[model samples]
Target: MKLLPCVYLSAKQDPTSKQNLSAAMKAGAQCHGLWVANYGNQQTNLRPWNRDQIEPANPVPCKVLIHQYAGDIANGLFDFNQINPFLENPELVIKRLILPPA
Candidate 1:
């Protein structure tokens, strides 16, 4: 099987509602990590490792690398994101998860 990065299409109720994640894996989509989305209240000067750790409402299927904490910034022009705080070495883990397999 080939190793491919996967992102969880996050939803308000169910994070994996957009696609059949399990079926995709069965069809050869390897999930190295996930990009979980969970919008928060704040919208300005957001940075990684700055905000309090806020997890998604619904349980995710795999390891999460990035968390989209806020959306509709600048009047729907941009969104905010951060590295997963739970990770021991977030920078290293993210690099490993995102880079093409060696």
Candidate 2:
């Protein structure tokens, strides 16, 4: 399964904020479409703007989709060790290490 990019907006966010949507697009979201999370079954569920929001200031390289995952499935469980391998790849440029230096 390919892990496509999708923007999940909550009730707190401004639905008309182009800047926020633009950021999501620049971050590599697929299809220029956004999925509203926790929308549940409702006739008034907010939908993404129908215009193009996939344009970004900086283009990303290697537009490949990876694995799929659901936030609710994992819940509160997290394992840094498991994800460390992916982050440790030499090809990945280190932006800012949030971890405290030894």
Per-residue CA lDDT of model 2 for 1-102, tens digit only, reads: 222333334323444544645555567743322332232222222233211222222323222112112222234422111112232342332222233377
Cα RMSD, each candidate: 4.9, 12.9
Which residue pairs show collisions in model 1?
Answer: none
How many residue pairs in model 1 have overlapping backbones? 0
- TM-scores for every predicted model: 0.54, 0.22
Point to the candidate with the largest TM-score: 1
In candidate 1 the C-alpha lDDT for residue 27 amounts to: 78
Worst 10 residues of 2 by lDDT: 77-86
